[model samples]
Target: MENGILARRRRELITGAVVLAALAVLPLPIADVYTRNLIIITLLFAGLAQAWNILGGYCGQISLGHALYFGAGAYVATLLFVNAGFPPLIGMFVGGAVGGLLALLVGWPCFRLSGHYYAIATVVVGEIGYLLFLNWDYVGGATGVYVPFKGDSWLALQFKTQKLPYHYVTLAFAAAAWFAAWLIEGSRWGFAWRAVRDDVVAARSLGVRVFASKMAAAAISGFFTGLGGAIFAQYVGYIDPESVLGGQFSILIALPAVLGGVGTLWGPVVGAAVLMPVSELSRSYLGGSGRGFDLMLYGALIVVVALARPQGLVSLLGRRRERARAA
Candidate 1:
């Protein structure tokens, strides 16, 4: 039975790898600059979604304040690169460290709260970060900071000629984030996180350090998200308080988690694949026409999904897969 299970798992892994390899490469053939940029942004947000999943999904902590990490990552990397003349690759790690530290600082206090109080604390922490970013002129404040455009320095994280580079780079980050999630899902740490998520008191009774597990989750999540933010800032060639640390940024991060499946490793990627294209299409059709069609569509989609499938897309897909297997 164990051998059979291992064989089945190997088959599943091989199949998934083939599909993802195809998705990553095949899109290049038909990708115009516009489409390439769109997909890159989609992948970037997907990475963020997966990072958020670590704390929010695995740990069962609903944090609307992930924008703090995302924004901090972007700002720190951008500031170091543009102002301090630091290489972006090094800046990325530094930004990630900052984000991880911030996560520890915030999570240490907020994790003590239970249920809605924890949620509220996250929101407050995010708001504080936003306010500071908005007022801090050293990093462009409300106006924003523009990355200096170098001719062709890959080291500077600047690619002037093609969107293909951006696409591949962002895809790499997304793949890494997904791989990390998969590794964590089957590890001892993952089991502990799930235990704490299910019942903190029970987990504590069983000798699980609930706070430490949650903090570890937060740290890992922040690192991935911060790295993604560095890529995002470089792609945009600009970063600002409003664009980097805003509520919209948080929404973009969380929407995939909600749409796809919160707790599963593949949920964010699947969610981004399904939801992002629709959103982009809606914007193209309904945006800037003095109509709220896109907003209406988003609202409708959320309502329908919530009413019909509260467990989310992953759960729905799992049910279908089981039925097919049984048949």
Candidate 2:
């Protein structure tokens, strides 16, 4: 059994390396700025989705208001960089720390409730945060803040003429998120989280500190999510409440994990790879019509995927592998 587990771990690591290598070179041949930008956005969301999965998938917290952490990260990093001349490379870590702390704060009360009630509580908390940021003049309020150009320094994480750097940055972030998930999946916390997810009563009876497990998952999830948000704020160079802290943004964060395969490592990446391109393309080509056609198409695709592959697209990969082994 030990040898089998070690062998599987080695295989997973090898597979991850190959995938990362392919992604690293993917944008090299593509000259289209739009295509490269799309890839970056996809990678960013993949990381965010994986982050969400740590709590929502593995821990079964089902939070609908992750935007709070995301927005908090963006605001913290942006504020530090713009006001104090702090480098965003370091500010992002600060943002992530704030995000993790904020998650614990939010989880403290919300975790008392279970199932949909907890989810609803999160949405309320998230909306309250949005409202606060929108009204608070300290963070620029509704006017939003623009990340200034301070030459093309990597310390600032600003690349004026090149999109390639941002691509690599997001790719690294996504890779890091994946690696984190891989580590967590093999940890004792992972086992406890799965037990809690499967049945809270059973988990508690088995002497698992259910609350601690959930809280740990939330902190880790929020940290990575916030880091992703900081990267996004830097990449776009502008952020507002509607852009970062809105309810829709929460849905966007959770959708990939749900569509890919909750509780599975590869699920978020697969879902993001499929969803982001379709969304970008649909919005680009169909959004011009302005009759809500783009949204309609996007909604239809999601519904189709949900109805057709309820277990998520990642399940297809498992089935294929099983068939190959059988052959």
Candidate 3:
């Protein structure tokens, strides 16, 4: 039995390594902009979702206003770059710090609420940020801010030649976020988060610092989400209130982890991969077929997936693996 377990683990490791290797070089032959852009977008969402998973999935803090942090990262970095000539590559930290700061401000008060109330509070905070930025002309208001394209500078993380560099950069961010999630999933903090997630009252009784756990998770989540925003703004060379700081952005960020398998390391990544393609394809092919047809398709998919597998699509595969081991 021990030998079999070890062999299975080794095989799985090898297979995972092989898949990653293939993906690392996937862009060598592809030259089409659409396909490359799709890959980059998928990776972008994956990183954002994974960051969100730290709080939402692990700590059970269902925030509907996560875009607050994401937009902060983008706007702050862009502002620093445009005004101070700080360069976005360096200002990314400022963006992350701002995100953590916002989380600190909100999580303290909002953590007092439970379930839907907490979620609603987050949405309100996000809306406030959105409206404030929409009116504040310093950051370009509703017109949005654009990163000055001063030729190609690696220090600024600007690449002018092709989308290939972006593909790898986004992949790096996704991979790094995934690795962080993996580490946190197995750490002492991870256990505390899981405890708090399962039952706050019960966890407190067991000497768990419920508030601290949730707050830590939220701060970390915001920090990474903010980093993603910085990368996104820099990559797109644009940032606007409606585009980055909206409720839709929050929904897309949080939904992927839940749809994949909340509390699991790769849940958000899997969810992003599945959700993005479906959404894009639906919007592309079904847009002219009927008004709101793409949204209808997306809704149908979420409902079907939720009803068919409440534990998520990952659970289905997990069960198969369990059966294989049993056999």
Q: Which candidate is the best by lDDT?
A: 2
TM-scores for all predictions: 0.94, 0.98, 0.93
lDDT of 1 at 3: 88
Candidate 3's C-alpha lDDT? 0.87
- Where model 2 places Cα greater than 4 Å from the true spot, the runs are none
Question: Model 3: which ten-residue window has the lowest total lDDT?
Answer: 8-17
lDDT of 1 by residue, 1-327 (tens): 778656755665676687569757855686477677778878887888999898888888888888888888998899998888998878987888888888888999999898889888988898899999899888778999999898667778888877877777788888878877777776789889999889999999999999999899989888887888888898899988888788667778888888888888777887887778778878888877758788778778867877887767888878997898899
Output the TM-score of candidate 2: 0.98
Q: Give model 3's clash tally.
A: 0
Residue 32 shift from truth in candidate 2, angstroms: 1.0
Give lDDT per model, in order.
0.83, 0.94, 0.87
| Position 117, candidate 2: lDDT | 95
**lDDT per residue, candidate 3, 1-327, as tens digits?**
879745754564565466557768997788888878888888888888999999988888999999999999999988998899898877987898899889989999999999889999999999999999999988899999988888887668788767887887788877777777766766789889999989888898989999899899999899888988988998999889998899889998988888898877667878988998888889899988999999998989889989998887788878998998799
